[model samples]
Target: MTSTPGERERRTSERVIALLMLLIHTRHGYTTAQIRRHVEGYAELGDEAFEKAFQRDRALLEDIGVPLSLEQPEDADARHVVDASALLLPEIDFSGAERRALLHAREVWSETRLQTEVMRAVGLLVDPGSAGEADDGLGLPRVVQRLTPNLEVFLDAAVEQQVLAFGYRTAAGAVSPQDRPRRVRIWSALEIGGAWYAAGWDLDRQGERLFRVSRVIGRPEELPGTGSDAPARPADWNPVEIRDRLLGQGEGLRDRVRLWVAPGRGHSVRLRGQAVTPTAQDGAAPGEGWELWETDRPAHDGLVQLCGGLMGVVQPSAADPDVVAEVLAAWRRVAEVHDGAPPPHPELAKPRQSRYRQGQRERVSRLLDIVGLANRAGGITKVELADRLELSPKALDADLRDLQYCGLPERLFPGWLFDVDAESDVVEVRQAVDLPAPIRLSLPEAHRLSAALDTVAQMPHADDEVAPAAVTAAARIRQVLADVGHTGATTSVRPSTGGTDDPGDAAAVVPSAADGGGAGGHEPPATPVTSFWDVHADQDTVRVLMDAVARHRVVRLRYHALHSDRTTEREVEPVQLVQSGVVLYLQGHCRTAGAMRTFRVERISAVEPTGEIAKARRRPKKTMLTPVDTTLEAVLAWHHRIRDLADDYAPRLEAQDADGRRLTRLGLLSEDAAIALAGMHAGDVEVLEPAELRQAVRDRALAALRRLETAVRL
Candidate 1:
């Protein structure tokens, strides 16, 4: 009888497992004829079918990192053998602090693309039952940084010392022609000011250069046989220094400028500067409750970024006569870009592909992990084993049956390589088949672990008494990978500490000067040092709030609400700190309002302990962490050029226009947020529906323009 597709796959899998077991367990390897005779499912196949199946299975095993090799005897056919020493990871015994650090890294990447890889890597070290129970992030501040596909490609290439070819966009937002792809050997890649960057040897230029990752036109391609020819990275290469030099920061003339800030606004800016009495020479007389503040900043471009980011709320003083004009010009440039027509074609569209193959790889990884886990436990209950592997009882039974077929040839040995006692309540592996330890980390897994640990290193520890566990753990893991010939780009990429200094700047959504202009020649205003992962809260405030959350204490907060432009003092029962997009929030029950509320951590100016234990309250549901309100919706239109930005809203594609612009429906939480989102992309995005929202965006831009005009007259 012909077998069904599922049955055929199962048979193939069992045959492969048996073949691997025989090769790994036997001292003198097995020849082709011996393998077919002993491995299950192989003897049932015809000569042609068996040859095809054996070749495919051998390739699969090698693809999954099984170091399979062939040995030739003096007077016999070649024998296939598995290289056990190269396949297993060296045993590592982690300390309490190191284990906690690993757990923290896992939590940080839980929602990212690296989640699966990171979880599997951590699983190799911690007990499956206890891994989920650790409160690793209890007293630590959290910062979520996004890793783009291009960034990951560059990271891998940096490790392998490969030369890359890709189209690059200038700071003015013009993409180089395809034929003129920039060739570079990346020495280092890193995150600075929330943007990803790579510093490398520009082959065409024959000198060191930095490329902002966001400006890369398309997926980079590796040049054939180029890594070996590239020069070694300089011993003293520093990514930070390269970034500062390229951006013209840290070595410029400084100027003291006064600003008129509106009340309850610019809280972050307030922290950086001091309040001053209003003076006639500063600008037009302050309106209503506006107050004057003074700050010393780098001249010209830096001043423009600071004032432009604070836009309407901040007016430059006469101390720097050209500062106001420069800021106004920058805004006009951005406005011009917004008012232009859409691009003829989309520039940065991401490829959407099925993840079926990825799922298959993960399953193979799990199977290998199970071997190590069962061997280490000696014997474990079937239910416990199923739970640990996240498989149903039926699925676990199938896996066990497959293992039963994997063993030495009957002529060579008496029993199977693995004695899986499925009939009993307990499942035990009597023979390990030389796979008692977990496999070495893959390149992607190593990069994810390194990046996650880098974020953990940047986080402020809640308790001063505790040592820096992340730093120590990172060093140990790096050494292990290095010893095994896996050199990942760990030292290159890292999280940035720079953030928007003005609280009002959160509302400012201008494009980076380094980004490309949409469809027109107009460029965006130079934005303040901001990251794609916008972290607004001060480190000290985060530390205090995290400590309070850990202790379950009631704290008083002086928060400035961006929607209402009001500053209010309230007592809140700290519950959990959550991150939504680039913004971090404190979810808790507010004693002052007598209700549950979510507060933006950045807008909070002061946090003081109320000297009272938090009252017993039900925790908010997981859905509450989402910032968007799905009930409200808006229609938006944008050229394919900004598909990356449009995808952020998880919009539904509505239709396509003749101009190659896409009409998409997006859910909105508030009108202000929608406006900010549109303004942030300049004119790349258009609000097609919700006439009120469209008007609101126009009104906001006009108001800012009027303010700029008035400042110019002063």
Candidate 2:
């Protein structure tokens, strides 16, 4: 593994966790022995390897930030069961904007340092959320295709731990530093700046270095793997420990360096006046004098500039004068980090593989301050800190050890003490870290067992294109159930409100996804199953036709009328897709229909021979069948509100059902028709037409009520 042992370990641990989540949800929960057996199958190695790997994995899951829980109920008490319900997977919530942000990150990583695992994670999170399942139907073929071109090449190179000879380029246009062919192991493929960069360990050079993806020349050729190159630290590792280790590596600057500030007309520097004590001369004349320090330098420019202006450094020999400029340049590059357009499906945007922030160092230091507020007064047990911080016993143990090393409290026994090192994994503390173990998970049935969870976890968010994602998800759930040949499992689609989930049983794990299902809480598992079949063609084709119609282009259609006996061909200019009752009716100047008539999609012969839009053709002016504000958004909101009220106004909903017993599609018309429809649905329906249309409906309702009163008196 030319890649850092840390990277592999982290990925392996994530894989283990992902697997465990799938298992727990599938088997409800498992015991320690069951977990060990099941985890061994997820891992490539044997029993010994699995046991060692599992112990480390268990500790990592319990760590702070990772956030997992363990429990032993009164019934499962003696079994040491792993309470998978406490996984807190549902606690992870991303806002619509945040969901959008995650998709944009895909473009950012389109090819950059954060490529492989980070990009994969992002894609995994987003695809399932939006567009039901990210597939060719979502029109993200380009994304997958683009990534595909180099995936196998990189994967092969990564696995081989061999030197990959290739040409390289940099954004700075820097050519290769080496004149001759250099042998090096490709450590990782990076996706930054919407471009790919393959960073590798230069055998000739011992330090870590970056490469620009665009500049790479020649086909990537991988050599054979080497034994020394595949050295391992551990197959399982804790991210918190890794972070702590990175911190402990050290910090300090020996020289006082001058830094030039950027061009900001009114930018002022803020200082932590209480923290840095000043000398007489340095304190008196800030810009003209320099302060000396024996510790690490402040990385933030505001602080650096404040420190510099308060105590100026004398321009000396050799230190880079462009240091400030360099930092500023990096800042400028990152300012647009979250600015890219979201992936077509917002769900594709997920949290990063790893995050790097300049201010994290300060945050880490502040952790010490926070700990002091609690422990310094009266020592807290590992369990207490664990509960407060929501850390697991193993994590609490590690935190305690780290605290102990910090000269806090000593000994595990309760006392009014706080002089123990946090780094110490005390035997007592480790033993005290009691947690529920895993339950029986069948590895052989992992995929089938996780169907519902996959659907829930990877659902889409409300966005443009198609109908409300909730409806689409409901439809997709039907597909999932259909695929599994289980029509008995009814589904109800509900909006995800970022709520806590039902605990313990896997079947109770019903999550509100970005989009797809039936009445909420049929089961609590995350359902992220992929829809292998294409469902978006109808909507997509309709969109294309609508675009052509708007642009006055002659479009070809390959329509498959689901209700019709067969598919058919047509060439027409679409005017509008009308909501005729509950079904979508296309109102176009159809060559076949021969008039400005509406054809229900369910009845239209398949739209065949769909090709390029003939934009030169002129479209006739017609009534706007749908609301001008009928954006993907307004439309979704309209439907979502209607669905929400259906439960409350079942009678009204039933009235519109056509079939009296079932509450099916509730139809909404253009503003003109909404009031008339409201009368049809009545108190069984409330005109939830966004207040813009409120008075119109209320007036009509009042008028109708008056008329009814007049008739009753007669």
Candidate 3:
């Protein structure tokens, strides 16, 4: 495309203004060695080039319409840094006409920058005869290239709070979003994929706006615009704050948000909302009926838009409709675009989400205790629950205090306090409160958690703690339950009327505790049991193991095995440390095994670090109870086969839609030490290769069934 003489003149003027504005934006800033680093990259910069650049930039910026204020640097950090307070710009807001003009500009010249190269690429894709012209669809690439660079520069401008002037193009070839493109001061920008984007209050567009760099046709000027320039802000403006005002979207905004959703859309609503919070009519399971999201703020509008077709907003905040209209417009325009539309605007998306939480469980139970105990018996004493969870009197009080703040706006939800009734132990559940299916905590089950957490809760708080490993210990418990093949599992835990059985409270995995350096994250699979405690592990033991891992040391152990019903002493090399749930298990090579194995940390009678090794041995236990093919080659082959089989076997086969879910259960041999031959990933199984081992499991299951039937009397 050839530029008209008029367009050529306009282009030259825009570039000059851009360069000047660039210099002005950098005025208040100063740094050492800047000359060497920043001065070398441009087309033709000199020894005094940078010093000249800054001055020229300021002059050019003022020549436009931006009025920038900068204070002289103080002697202290003068040579190295610029003071922010001194350099400031006036407020800026785009008029409706200006925004519309800007949007028009964006539509037109957005691709003109790379027109030359872009056309060449298109020529390769489409024949002139077949396509009529090579440039038919080639313009998009040109626009796409320029937009990123301009957006990148603008993003930097936003972060730095510096003024910028660049040519903006509209759909009808107008330079401005309004009637004509004019030199303007851009105060800030937004960041995406390490690049900057500048979306602001467009005076021409009449609302918030987004500008893609691809549409910019001129260089950036750093100086504030002067007298005749229309871009300068009036004095007394906080550009940075203004930027936030535009980009903040709706933080902490509340509205009586009403969403009318279709029946099947309940799950969609929860997932889209990114939290299971159903803002329905005061109390009820989210999907049982029409879903309502009672938001304290303006976040509700986004949800309504997302659930569109299946949902619509009712009696929303005044801002809702406008925002909705904008979204729908964008959706309509981009929805069917498979040619890869630009990334969606971050300003439009909901803010990054916080982690999910489970607040209702303890709230209900504690509410039961509060109403049942306090109102009738002057608040149940710590001693009452002391024997139940095996908690100390002081710990019981701590637990109660924990339940107190659960669900108030301040705490954020039913406050966790006296919300429970102590007399009948009835919780003040709303009319919609559905009684939770009971949770069965067998003493044995509780004991496993108790033993696992027993060691962790007791560990001396380290100055700096690494990741927590309790989940691994918890996984062992879960695996056992899964093996039990239970579904819709519901059981009740009866409090002991007898005095406290001090298995010790092992509720460390409780949701109430969320620590940055605590029990969550990935763990490698378990090593075979070489020296693990066949018995139970206490909390103190869990902590010891964690310490061993962090410090990279070995411990002398006195381990008890339930299989042999005996105890043995040995020195084991601590290898990989694993934490599952509240229990800490060591998956290190053991001297006892002559290889690696899983050692329950709590069961170790004592831990004495003879020396510390920086690296832990990374393999499974060498010793085994049964004489199995133990060579590395054989182990590898077995591990490979099992994985292949697991892929096919994991999903059960059944006759009906629901028949196969539970009845067609498969259990692999995990207890035998030899079963550990499979690689670590098979924490679920130890058969080395899935392909062959699946057949072996069938053979074993049949044999076991036969044995069981024969034992039964007719």
Candidate 4:
């Protein structure tokens, strides 16, 4: 009978563990012939099978950071030995504050792809029993950072020093069949401004370049040769500084630019600029009145592009005719695009395949932990072992059985490395193994820990407490990894703070000038950086809300509703914080509205505790955070160009039009939301059903055009 995948995996695990235990237990190590003759799995295999299995097991051990060394005596078969000292993680004492800060930093990646790695790293470093349960009182907002599909490809390339080739799209262009292909030797990978970026030496250009992960047109393939043929990364290389130099080339206006804003709109603009007194000379006011704001222009073409996106609400002052003309031109282009027939959907980039199975790595990690845990306890009960490791009884039994077969060849050693007394419900090691101490951190694990520490270090903290501790802890870990020859793993990639001028400002969405092609088929000037939405919320606001929630207090909020284009004040009983994609939401029972509501953290203009204790109430059922009710649904047709956004709506594809537009039914919270969605991606998205929504989108677009014309002629 053919063995199942489970049996194969168990056999592989047993063989690898047995080899490791044998090498560590015997100082002189074992030759291949001796290992094959003695190891249980190898003894049962044919000569050809034994060779492949032995080689695979050896590679697996080395890949996971096991310090396995090969030694050859003259005219003798090579011997594989485990460097016990090098395999152990060095002892680094952490202070109380540092420990708390480190734990908190680890918590930030709670639900992210890196969570498992972060947890494993923490488990190895901190004594779980002594490290008091992560303080839940603070209720830190959970951050969900989505890794780009190509991130692993780049990471592996960097670590292995390999060359990679991929199709790359520039900031000004979408992914197309005619995309320019580029080859690179990846030096580092980092996340900045909520977007992942790979920095490396462009092989074709013979210069360093940075490429946005999302802009990669297709899967990156590894080139045959290693990066050893290319120049090494500079000693002073810093991805952040290099990215800034490359992207921040242009200068902004030296003086402040005057802007007229409609009431309750342009919050992102307002937050950056100061409100100015509007005069009669400012021209005709729209809505209640045009609020005049003057703020320093951002670097490059950011100011123009920023104002262009807020055409209906924001207008540049006539004092600068050039700026006004540019804004007007942008508005006209948007209007023309909306008026024109929808363009065919752009070709979407193919999702890259992950290099390895996460489950496989996790399983290996669990097995290693078992050995370390069992060794530390001298002998642990099976029930206690299962509970501690969070494993089912069956799994525990299976692992024990695998461990029982792992040892020196039966001829060399009479018994297995680990002896399990199933009847007594006890697991004990019969022979000494160097694995009692935690193994060195793997490259991926180190990267995750480094990234998490970088995030915590950047966050705002009271008295600047946690930030300093995080920075110190990161440096210590980096040094430890480097000392252990894990230099590649120590490369830290920090997620940028949205590149905002004001640190306190929440992540804002600045529309790309090239989003809508202009009239006459003219391409807009390339943006300094690709448009990206930051996922991190304002730390100050999140901290206050968390406090209120912990105290069970009623809080007053000044929230700006995007769909309605209005700000409202309401009292709410703080409940929990929820993170979905690039948006953070505060889910609570709204006392003012007498209903459960989810408020976007970015839209919350102000949060103040009312000092009123909230009444006891049952927690609301967990639901996805959306602006509107799910019961009301809207049918929309969106071109594949904006498929990423469409995918967020849990869309059911009804049909595809000739233009490659997909008709999808999506849930809507309100009519205004449907209109806002269509208007935001106008020309790319159309309201297919609910005739009223289509008309509303048209009216909004026309009104915006009229407003732009009025502002231009002033």
Candidate 5:
């Protein structure tokens, strides 16, 4: 009797698992005859049928990321042995804090789609039975939210750098039910005020846009076609910068408004409010709980809308005749919005879109370029590939994993598809696919490069060789654009003021001041071109610290601590570099303090690598995308417009206040963090406690104002 297809599949799966177990647990090689005798399913099949099934099973295992290997028989006594790693799952080395954070996140997101993902990830890393038993006396001091299903899909696409098209619900069904669909390339996913938003490059608008996860009506499906047409992002594009810009949407000049939110609805609000209280106030409805909060922020419709229904203006008393009508009017407008009418400011109700992060896209493009170049070179080692891409080995491995599925659908059998063979010490690219020639230079790249070349050519006493070379390269790039039939005036090249007369000679085709080096013919040649590597610290010092971190070496640093108000020498085992906003911090183990510490790169006056491997290796080996400090905790408050900044600092949300203000416990690295918060927001930020930090902020503010006065005089 013939077996049903389902039966055959079940049997096949069982056989595959059995085969895997045999290979994984066996101490010695097993021949085909020996395997047939030992295994159940194979015993029922003839040699031909068994061989076909074995081949199919091997392919399935390989496809599933199983590191399977076959050792060939070389001599009479030797046999072909199937060799594989002992464990099917890769070991997870998350720190106690990270695991705890993940555990809490899983619990928080339990009912949502993100909960499953978090649980799965955590489950794979930790034993399910031991999940929440004990704590390590460490609080990551950050709120973790679940990813809506829509977000997970978009995030995956973003990681793959794939373009997506999806339906976005601009208005609630109670408002505008019509579906608004758009095509975009996902650049970032951020959580602000406990809501998730995705920012990306809008294909139709030829600009960047943001979408709220809750506003997204359905799962985003991958758009058809290669992402070749997507414009290249700028090399200096910073995601945090774009996120901050988006977060600042509709913000006005500072408005300090005291308010109270209903109990249980004040978490987002309290993260930025000073003197947050959770209790029913005098006029609160009986049995109704209230959270009182005060905050200073730029007044935007977003703030008013956030406070509506859930919170209300408490100070500038509602009973006061001077402001009673204004407060009543604001609440009335909010009431109208909830009643299915248009918001007083429709824009405030809509999600805020931000400019595409140019730097991240450039990094993705560079990754693709490096992979293509290395693959085309034939058999380039992984080390060489990493060196060429200027990426760490860990980073390079991640890129390769993402790029493995980057080709056109495998159904077409295109020879241009790429595959990575990462078995040996070297990474081998097999079945290489050629990259489709990029249609044109990214606008920012061309614009910036042109300005740099022009500046170099015009520099006083510039080296003849360098100046001429810059001019020649610029002209060639412009010529390529012109040859591609671009009709824009930016394609034009003019002669340099003192360039060679020969058309074929270097500097012969430098664009004149009028042409602006063939970059839109707009900006003057002297316009400054921003460098991607601009930083507050010495480049040499940063390089040294980065090397120490990578090599797991100790470094002696002359570091300035804002809390202590002094500079001192300390030996630190470099862990990793973290970027918060525009500042870079070196997180490591400090021998002086006998604990892990975070030191700002800018605060380090000098760094000398010890050249010895560090003994302290307790710090997590992986990089953190944001600031995380287990040592110091500061309870403070602020306005909501700066929510992105607060999240970047990884502050733990406590309670909500009226209109975009909330209380939070922020994890601090050093006094620099307080200074950073104070400086970034000026009077808006109130550093509460530790007395030292508060004084530091005051001193820094006074010093900043003094510097401003001095500059004004100069």
Candidate 6:
């Protein structure tokens, strides 16, 4: 079976290239006959051999992130064309400055075990030479290792919303006792402030708690699972915030306290807003060493240790009779809390896991959002879908594949999973077989879905049967929320803007509507709110406008123009609704203006769909927000002493001289912005800009220096 040296390798390479070229060159899909006739290697193979080869090649192409599709031929006589988008390797879009940043990153990453893999990936994605240039020869040791195995397992379970049974090791090295299972519905696996922590409702504790992945004694065993019991993550849960709260790691005052510290040495505390003054004490020396310090009682143990040298209880006074009683009362409460328990292992209390797994939540959330959107739209075009999701076509395809592979445990069958169909020019997705019946819902999603169903019932020509079913579904959702202890959950429904109607009446299904078909003699289905509008939006108006936009329909609006200072009614073909800051603006082609205009949602007092569908037109990609001017450029020269600041603040390296001085160009909007930036990073940044800006910064610095000198004299 041995061939000439490199013959086999060369053949595969040539075939791969030839196959790519064939796929790229063909606009219309090529059938098996066309592929055999056109592709170089396929022509030489026999029927069965070609079948195996074609399948392998197609699979290989897809494995490398190519968007390949298989579809039934339109004509039964024709073989299926392997429909695929042209495979173009993504161009490295790193700017010169970004490249330099990556080069610095490469230097940092090179010290790790990931060095080889990172370099290989970088070489494949971008040029290796560019990545290797300007190595900052400071060889720092790797501090972060690859994610621990337990962290990965926890992350996988969290994404699937599965319950895991595991033996967690306590700080005392005691593992979970046998016979009793510790089951938890993993809410999230997070790396906050560089450590990994997995949080969830501890089925055993009946309350939420976190665990350190590193302290997990053994592999977490997946419990026999059902979707119904998936616990809700806390409503106001932020991994970092939760971790900080749980660890009691913040600067806060517990009680008013005063201390006397070594004078001048207490500047650290004084700088933190503590009032400091020379103490009135019985001392022989005129210039005493001790100074009175009054501040909030330092909350953290570290802060307590820092204040240990100080004379304590100055405010309460050690002589106060109640101080002893207060101390005893505090001790009694502590004794009651920790009476007979070996304190929960320190690891259990403060999980010190790595943060590499933090983005898992975002990935799962995005996947669900995509699925939900696709289900509502029935199908969406690939380009539009990508734009809505803010992803590249290639990235979309990759994520789709990820989605296709994700689902409930029952998704072992192909039909159970979400399916993508891109046979035609437009790509469509078949929603997962097990949607509308998921294991659990994030609270916000449940509320949103409930509101959407209510909106759907209000639409003209909506079936009566839909209302009762929707009501039942909404009740079940509320029950689910209740089951998860979210008792006071309310529907975030907004009123209809077309008419002055009660918000409650808006949710009630109407018995009948005036039956009149529009120009096409077909009544459009009522619009439902799809996009989560800004918090300040008139939900009713936004719903109507978004509905019109989705159906390519026109809407009549009573809008008050800020410039005109007048309210006028006008018909607009709602193109899209965009959010900027706290305001939602409807960007549409105005019949009155005869051009595309963006109207603030608040100004639009009324909205009524005009029943007329708009002719398809290309939407403007540009938004109303003007791009910030980065015209004010500065060349910052930094001394070697300020190398760390230079690394942090510099946008691009302009030059580095023999004396270890670095010059960097910083693009800014105005002198004010530059001044603010330089002031924030004062001493580290030397601005050499439009002489005026430089002079202003210099003057500000001198003024500050003069103030300090004056204070010293006083």
Q: Candidate 3, TM-score vs. the true structure?
A: 0.23
Poorly placed runs, candidate 5 (over 4 Å): 1-532, 543-554, 609-621, 624-643, 654-665, 668-680, 686-714
Candidate 4 residue pairs in backbone clash: 38-409, 628-669, 629-669
Ranking, TM-score, top scorer first: 4, 1, 5, 6, 3, 2
- Which lDDT tens digits does candidate 1 get at residues 426-447? 8777666466666666654665
Best by TM-score: 4
Relative to the unseen true structure, what is the Cα RMSD of model 3?
A: 33.2
Tens-digit lDDT track for model 6 on 319-416? 22243234323323322322232211111122233344313233443455455445545565666656444557886776676555444222122243
lDDT of 2 by residue, 274-313 (tens): 1234433222211223332322232222222222221111
CA lDDT, every model vs. true structure: 0.60, 0.33, 0.31, 0.61, 0.45, 0.44
> Which 10 consecutive positions of candidate 4 have the poorest summed lDDT?
516-525
lDDT per residue, candidate 3, 1-714, as tens digits? 997964543333333322322323354443423322432222245658655655554443332222334434657333322222221211113233222221212211111221221222112111222322211211110111122344435533432234455666432233443334433334333221112235433333333343444446566655444313222222222322322232222234333343334344333233223323443223332223544443322222233223221212121222244443443343332222212222221121221322223132222332333323333333344444343223455544544444333222221122322243323322232221211111222212222232222222222222112113222333433444344341112232321121101111111111111111122222212111000111124434445554565566777777654222245676666654443322345665567777656554444555666675646444343322122333311121111112222221222221111111111122333422222221112222322233344334333333322322232211
Rank order (by lDDT, best first): 4, 1, 5, 6, 2, 3
Q: How displaced is residue 85 in candidate 2, in Å?
A: 29
Q: What's model 6's overall lDDT? A: 0.44
lDDT of 3 at 373: 33
The ten-residue window of minimal lDDT in model 1 covers 521-530
| Residue-level lDDT tens digits of model 5 in 450-537 | 4334433332111123334445544544454345342123212321122101111111011112111111111122111211111234
Task: Tell me the lDDT of candidate 4.
Answer: 0.61
Q: In terms of lDDT, which candidate is stronger, 1 or 4? A: 4
Candidate with the larger lDDT of 2 and 4: 4
> How do the predictions measure up, each by TM-score?
0.75, 0.22, 0.23, 0.79, 0.33, 0.31
Greater TM-score among 1 and 4 belongs to 4
Model 6 residue 472 lDDT? 46
